[model samples]
Target: MPSLRSIRSRIRSVKNTRQITKAMEMVASAKMRKAQQRVLDTRPYAEKIYELMHRIASREKAWSSPFFETRPVQTIGVLLVSTDRGLCGAINANLFRSLVRFMKERPGVRFEFVTIGRKGRDFIRRSGFNLTGVIQGVKDRGTIEEILPATQLVIEEFSEKKNWQEAWIFYTQFESIMSQKPRHEKLLPIDPEVLTGSGNPPNGHSGEYLYEPDRRDILDVLIPRYFETVIFQRVLENFASEYSARMVAMKNATANAKEVIYGLTLTYNKLRQANITKEISEISSGAEAISQG
Candidate 1:
């Protein structure tokens, strides 16, 4: 059994750890709220742009646009969005696992990575993949400008005929406070079928729309803007997921620390009682000896 002093010291240490974890949990909670709100606020615009782009691409003339062109899949450009920091449970782990699974599914296809956070960048480096671009140190409430460089990198790579034939993005989609899932989405070659809801227009709107100036000119601007919006929305989702995961992880840590403190306090009390009992017994023995003497 450990000494009472050592047990007391351990209890104090655990209490301090619990305080830190509790503080982190609170901070994560506040950030999570803001991140979640941002995701919610921007989702409508993202969806509408996606719908509009799909409507345009549904036209036969829209196929002439480079953004609508599909080629044989040989090499793919992958954009991975991850949290900048750690202590967020298995969020990053799940993303990497999904990436590994995706790679396994496409055995012969080559991938060039573009990372949005330090964790993803480090993973690409460790995995010995070709990292084309990196955007790091983005804030919790990051703006589109912060991510524009990586977006442009992906766009430029896809635009070149000799480069990647496909571009995909991997991110954690925020479902709720307790649920976040890693999502793999096609970022380029805009799948009109997928986005247009399988031939059904969104909200039952007839796909008859007149473009201002000309259709080609409108798509030239709309397609890129739509792509950027999608990327930005995904980033916002990742931010929310990061905060949610961190909040839950810290909450669990705080609770576990409390359990440790409780168990240690119980042990300390038991040890101290035993010591007091022993001392009382020793004193009684001495008293009896003196009386007998």
Candidate 2:
């Protein structure tokens, strides 16, 4: 059994840790609320752009954009997004696991990865994956311009490289506070169905509209903008998912800390009682010895 002084010191240390975890839990809760609101506000716009893009692609037979052009797969580009910090539970691990599975399946094809956070970059580097670009410190509220440089570079690299056929983005999709799932989505050769969210054509809107500035001309600008929208929404969604995961993880940590403190308190009390009982017995024995003498 440990001494009373040692138990007291341990109890104090655990209490301090509990306090820190509580603080982190509160901070994560506050951030999650803000992030959730931003995600809700942006979803409609992203959905609409996706719908419109899909509609355009489906309506015109000859109308085509480079983004919609599907070619043979040789070299692939993967944009992996994850948080810089841990303690957000399995968010980064889940992403890395998915990436590992994806790379494993396509062993013959070369992979050029673009990592959007410190965790993702460190992961691929440590695993000896070919990293093409690294973007770190992306703000919780990132702008299109912030991601534009990286997006352009990926596009340019794909255009310049003959073997590179497609680009994919692996990220966590935020469904609810309790449910964030790692998703594998193609970022290049933009699938019209993917943008619209409805892989099938909506019967009501298919034949109603006529093109204004020629279908090809409109697609030239819309396709790239559509791609940008996808990237923007993804970053926002990624931020919201991070907050939600962190909030849940911290809450669990705080609960676990409380449990630890409770167990320690019980032990401390038991130890103190034992010490007091031993002292009383010793005192009584001394008195009895003196009385007997």
Tens digit per residue, CA lDDT, model 2, 251-271: 888788788878888998988
Across 189-270, the per-residue lDDT of candidate 1 in tens digits comes to 7777775555565556554577688877877788778878899999999999999999999999999999999999999999
Question: Candidate 1: global Cα-lDDT?
Answer: 0.88
lDDT top scorer: 1
Q: Cα lDDT for residue 239, model 1?
A: 93
RMSD of each: 2.0, 2.3
Cα-based lDDT at residue 258, candidate 1: 93
